[model samples]
Target: MNVTVFGATGAIGSLTVAELLARGHTVTAYARNPAKVPASWAERVRVVIAEISDVQAIDSAVAGAEVVVSALGPSMDRTATGLPLVDGTRHILAAMATHGVTRYIGHGTPSVLDPEETPTIQTRLIGLMGRTLLPRAYAELLGMTDLVTSSAARWTIVRFTAPKNTPRQRHLRVGFYGTTRIGFAVGRADIAAFTAAQVDDDTYVGRAPAISH
Candidate 1:
């Protein structure tokens, strides 16, 4: 499979690229600074340097990908206010549509999913904090979700709880918020594994599944 990963320098994005390569899939790591990509991966994957906001650059990068995985998130810089995630996603969808690529797998927080699943007190509190403290980011994430849900391509949004740099358990609790009892945190490697696995999975297409543990 030919995979193009946006925000490839990010924690989870880098892991996803490594996972894809480990599974014998060709990968294109796209980021603003190619230098950020791990030196070890240089020989294994192709590197494309470009900003996600550049639609033409995105279109060219996504041209022949069999699957596109995005690990983009709100900028750590507080002054940044534009909807990069939403805008980047729109470009990705448009490019995919133009290139005939259907599979897309992206990551998000559990706050984006419904809390109707008899969520524990911890889950509710986390969701509340995310909405209250990062309202703008949450709004952008919602906009991104709207764009994805309305797109013509096959998409999967993997919602997760707090991610830590822990070892992969290879075990996950997966389902909608109301149906899946997620843990407080999950390993970044596990999240990458799940994202990579979705490339061949149709069960989660068009749905956002909250995963943890």
Candidate 2:
């Protein structure tokens, strides 16, 4: 697979790129600062310098690639909003459509899934707070989902719950949107491996699934 990964310098993005390359897939990684990529990856995979918000840049980066994966995230700041995640996703989808690339996998938070499941009180409280307090980020994430799934493309949105830097494990749990039970913490490497697996799995297309240990 000729995979193009946006946010290749980010935490989960870099892991996804490593997993793809370890599988012997040719990867083109898009990063704003190419120098931020590890020396090993810089030597192994093709690195393209570009911002995800730039449509032309994205189109060129993913050209000739079969799968486009995005792990883009917005850093939290009081003065900042989540426009980067929302707008960057729109630009990525537009580029994919224009370039005739149909397959996409995106990183999202598990918190945005609709609460149809019988979740623990702790999880339910968190959702309520997100809806009432962090509405901007919540709305942005939901909007991204709507754009990706509605587009003329095959897309899987992977929602994750985890504290940072957890260790990888086989047989990680998957919770589909609206399913019962909240997912526990999962490792970053596990998330990468799962995304890599989804490259060929049609089962997850147009759906959102939460990943955890």
Candidate 3:
């Protein structure tokens, strides 16, 4: 499989690229900052450095990709400007359509509720905090969520809560809210593992599962 990763410089995204490589998949890493990519991955992965808003650059990145994973995360910065994540996702989807790519795995929070779910305590608190403290980002994430779910592509929005800088918990509890017991925190490497595997796994298509340790 040819997998292209957006936000490849982030903590989880970097891990995802490596995971894909380890799984014998060709990976094209899309990152804004070249310095953030590891020196070790230089020879093993294809690197694309450009702003998320550059439609042409984004299209180029998704050109021949069979699977597209967006590890683009939201920020809590109140001053964070614009809907770059949402808009960049729109561009990615369009580019995926331009080519023949169908599989899309993206990241979101529990605050972006799945249609079948009722709000849980964690979701309620997260929603309250997002609406109060991170209004712009919350709105933007919702927009991004809308685009992915409503798009023509096969999309899986992996939702989570606290992402800890811990070792991979190979065992994970994954389900929608109110349906299963899930913890508030999870390991970043664990997230990368599950997300990268989605390229070949169709079990979660059209569904957003909250994953945690």
Candidate 4:
């Protein structure tokens, strides 16, 4: 499989690249900062250095991809401005469509609701905090949700909250909010594992499944 990962310099995205390599898949990682990418990976995977807003760079990165995974997300900043992720996502989806790529695995939070989800205390609080505290960033995330779900691709938004730097966890609770009880926190490693696994797994395609330990 030829996998291209956006936001590859991010914590979870880096792990996803490693997991994909471990599972015998070729990887193309798009990194904004060349310094953040490991020198060891230079011989192992293709690295494209470009900002998310670089349209031609993004198009070239996804040109020959079979699966695309995005760990791209807005920082949890209350003062976040200019929906960068939303615009970047729009370009990414357009590139995928032009390149004839179908599978897309992206990241999001529980605040981006699923049709099957029923409001829970945890969910309600998440929504409230997003709107009250991080309004701009929250809106950007929702904008990303709208684009991903509406695109012509087999997409999966791996949703979670409070990711920790803990080791990978097993038996993750993966499902919608109402039916499945999920915790507020999960290991970043676990999230990466699940995100990488999505390249070959269609169980959650066209659905956003919140995963937690």
Candidate 5:
């Protein structure tokens, strides 16, 4: 598969790129700073530098790619800035559609899931607090969810809770809307592994899988 990963220099993006390459897929890592892309991948993959929010730039970066993966978390802690998530996601989706690319895997927060089905009061409270304190982010994520849900392409929105820095466990628990506390905590590598896996399988297409370790 020829894969393009947006925000490829980010924490999760970098790992996903590596995993994809390890699996022998041709990977393209897209980021604003090409220097941020690892030197090791320089020879094996193509690096495209451009702002993800720019429609033309995104279109060019994803062109000719079989699958698009987005790990586009805010560069900085934006709990206070309250930047928009859906707008960026919309741009990516639009770019993909324009380029005639269909398969997509997007990284999303667990807070976007309904709180009623969450495992414990703590998880629900945290999600509620996030919605209260960072309403814009949550709202935009909701919009992103709606867009992906409505899109005609094959898409998987991987909803994850606290992302740990631990090593890859190679284990994951996946659940859809009805599963409570499906995604409580997961390692970054584990998330990357699943993301790479999704490029080949349409198992999660048109579904939001809450992932946990």
Candidate 6:
């Protein structure tokens, strides 16, 4: 499979690129700073430099891609009001549609949904942060979700709790969370593996499943 990964320099994005390559998929690491990608990947994948807002750049980057994976989010330098999630998603969907690319997988936050399991104190605090302290970011993510859900392509938005830097467990609990319970902390490597696995999974297409270890 040919995969184009947006935000490829990000923590989880980097791991996703590695995981895809390990799975023998051709990967294009798309980022604003192509140099940020690890030197080790130079011989393994294609690299494209472009801002997510640049539709033409994105269109060109996604050309010939079989699957598009986005790990885009607000940078710490910017506040929630400046998030590129919504607009970026719109551009990605448009590019995919134009290029006849159908599979779209992206990362999302658990704050977008109501807690179905008994809320841990940590979960409650995170929810409060998203709804109260980071309302703008929350709203932007919701808009991104709506855009993806309405798009013509097959899409899967994997919502996760806090992403940690721990080593990969290779074990994940996947659920809609409306009826099932998952953990609150997941390793970044695991997240990448699960997201990459969706490239060939139709079960989660058109659905957003929250995952945790």
Top candidate on lDDT is: 3
- TM-score, candidate number 5: 0.86
Q: Which residue runs does candidate 3 get wrong by more than 4 Å?
A: none
Off by over 4 Å in 1: 114-124
Could you give candidate 1's per-residue lDDT for residues 36-150 as a string of tens digits? 8798986888888888889999998898899999887776455678888888899999999999999888877666654234565665787687778777777777788778867
lDDT of 4 at 160: 94
Where does candidate 1 clash, by residue pair?
A: 117-178
| Residues 72-165 of candidate 5: C-alpha lDDT, one tens digit per residue | 7643345455445567778878878888999988877665553234345554665797688666666666677777767877888888877999
TM-score of every candidate: 0.91, 0.87, 0.96, 0.96, 0.86, 0.89
lDDT for 212 (candidate 5): 83
The runs of at least 3 residues in candidate 6 whose Cα sits more than 4 Å from the true structure, single-residue gaps closed, are: 77-80, 114-126
Q: On a 0 to 1 TM-score scale, where does candidate 4 land against the true structure?
A: 0.96
Per-residue accuracy of model 2 over 1-213 as CA lDDT, tens digit each = 899998898888899998898888899999998679799874788888877677788878878899999877655454666567778888888878787899999877665552343455555665676568667766666777777767888888888755468778757778664454546677888888899888878887877777777
Q: Per-residue lDDT for 5 in model 6?
A: 94
Distance from true position, residue 184, model 4, in Å? Answer: 0.3
Q: Write the per-residue lDDT of candidate 6 for residues 85-157, one digit (tens) a residue.
A: 6898899999999999999998787755532344555556667878786677767777887788788988888
Q: Candidate 1's error at 17, in angstroms?
A: 0.3
On the 0 to 100 scale, the lDDT of residue 213 in model 4 is 92
Q: Which stretches of candidate 2 lie above 4 Å from their native place?
A: 114-126, 177-180
RMSD of 3: 1.1
Flag the better candidate by TM-score, 1 or 4: 4
lDDT of 5: 0.77
